[model samples]
Target: MYVAVKGGERAIENAHAWLAEERRGDKGVAELSVAQIREQLSLAVNRVMAEGSLYDPDLAALAIKQARGDLIEAIFLVRAYRTTLPRLGASKPVETGEMACDRRISATFKDVPGGQLLGPTFDYTHRLLDFALDAEGEIPEAQSGEPQAAPVPHITGFLNRDGMIEQEPQGDATPPDLTREPMEFPANRALRLQNLTRGDEGFVLGLAYSTQRGYARNHAFVGELRVGTVPVEMEIPELGFAIEIGELRLTECETVNQFKGSKTEPPQFTRGYGLTFGMTERKAISMALVDRALRWRELGEDDLGAAAQDEEFVLAHSDNIQATGFLEHIKLPHYVDFQSELELVRRLRREAQATRQDQQEAAE
Candidate 1:
């Protein structure tokens, strides 16, 4: 008895117009420029780029602006835009050892090769809101000091000297790209790391938290965390030599986890790795924890049926865009299905009443 809804097209058009007006906000306030977003809200831009799997800060800022500050929507916009661009050549993997670090710290060691630099971090700051920032003023110039030495050695290398840490086997095998190919279960470590890198930050954080709360608890220690810029190089076919294309800001984390000795292996600390665009230490650390948790099978640990331990579960639901698409699709018309269910429920109720009346008459 349900009639199909009409004027949906017009409704959608009107909704879009309203949305546009809402995005712009008050007419008295000036429109936000993409450049301003890129410079001022650089961390947000970094997050969009990291999740979007794209590096252009300007584009990320524009996406943010267009999406009205909704980061997931911005990430989706960047991802969609990424598909249209033609793939050129792949870049050579940048070496993190040679990274010019701005901020470097180690929880495992007191003093590393280069002293731990506490570069721009909010860790020590009080949570009080700085109302002074409400009125914009010129930022004071940062004081410059003696240039620190480069090529800081990884903390894991120290543990590796005596074979205290589990050694990761070096391989030349190319990793499968989740974006390019459909995801298959039982993903390798490289593939898992790649997925985690671009996975939704909040989702990954929650999964990581579950591990610490005794759901497949793996004792994790931050071995080293470094944030800095590294040169990206690519080999040109014409030149026959790798050339430095550009430098990219990145954050890398290495976590040392305790692993019990098994039948085939001696007891040693296993390592979990995380790397992301820009200074996203929390995401990197969470990623490392989740990455280690996912490796329970490979490391010869018990599965324990943990959410983080399930490869299929983690990889399948990690993408916000895919998750949102399916979740939001429930808003679409389901009148036919609802009507059928309604009729079935009514018939069932009538049948139950009739059976009750027949029982009463028989008793009488």
Candidate 2:
């Protein structure tokens, strides 16, 4: 009888309608326009873009609005939509050395050649509630600063001067797309970074924080954090050459982690790299730290059984959608299992009663 369970489709449809009604909330208040959500709730949209691996701000904004500002739902929407998109081609890497940066900061050197630009950040602002925002006032204009020409020099290039850092070789190695391919063990750098990019922000942050707390302790310093738009170049078969397909806002974090330098690897600085979609600096920085922790084997460091050091643990539980889906799915019908357990309990009780009655008879 329990096997005959049905009506999942009906339940799903009703739930969707109820959700829509709930999102609207009485239909008397003014509806939140997509533009308003896009402009005002931009940080939420940035998160969606970062996790979804899509670069279109307008689409992300629309998804956020559709999701009623539920950022994870917005990410799901974007991810679903992207799945149907036709594959145009792959792009040549946007050279970080040639990135036209809006904000760039390096923690290593106090007086680097290209000076630190504290661009748009909420770092120093007090966390006090602004009652003026509740009154629906317009935001103030940004303080004007003189803009420089394109093609900003990278901080890493400056580090090349002292030769303190190990040089990363430029290669034509094709990066694997995690969405299309099943993730295998001993994942390459490209795959690991891809997984981290779409990983849950909070999960990555906590894991990164754990490293500071002595789990696979890697003495890490944020070498640089940069945010800006980068050109995506793709090869056109018809055109027979690569062309700029479009641009995307990105956050890149390079962490300088302490490595004791094994017999194989010489005593020099090792790198922990993170690159994520959009201007998600916190997530990007966390990604770098966690990435460094995962590289214990390659760096010749002993694995201290840290959560971040466990690739299986991190990748398996890092996705909010997958985690929530599996978690919430327990609410689905399990009457069969319940009934089976019920029968087992009843039989056990009956056997115990019979045994008790026999023992009573024997005693009598």
Per-candidate Cα lDDT values, in order, are 0.90, 0.84
lDDT (10s digit) by residue, model 1, range 32-73: 999999998999999999999999999999999999999999
Total backbone collisions, model 2: 0
Clashing pairs in 2: none
**Poorly placed runs, candidate 2 (over 4 Å):** 1-4, 8-14, 348-364
lDDT of 2 at 354: 100
Best by lDDT: 1
lDDT over C-alpha atoms for residue 41 of model 2? 78
Model 2 lDDT per residue over 141-250, tens place:
98977777656676766666787777777788888887889888888778898899999999999999999998987888888888888888988999999889888778
Misplaced by over 4 Å in model 1 are 1-6, 357-364
How far residue 347's Cα lies from its native spot in candidate 2, in Å, is 3.7
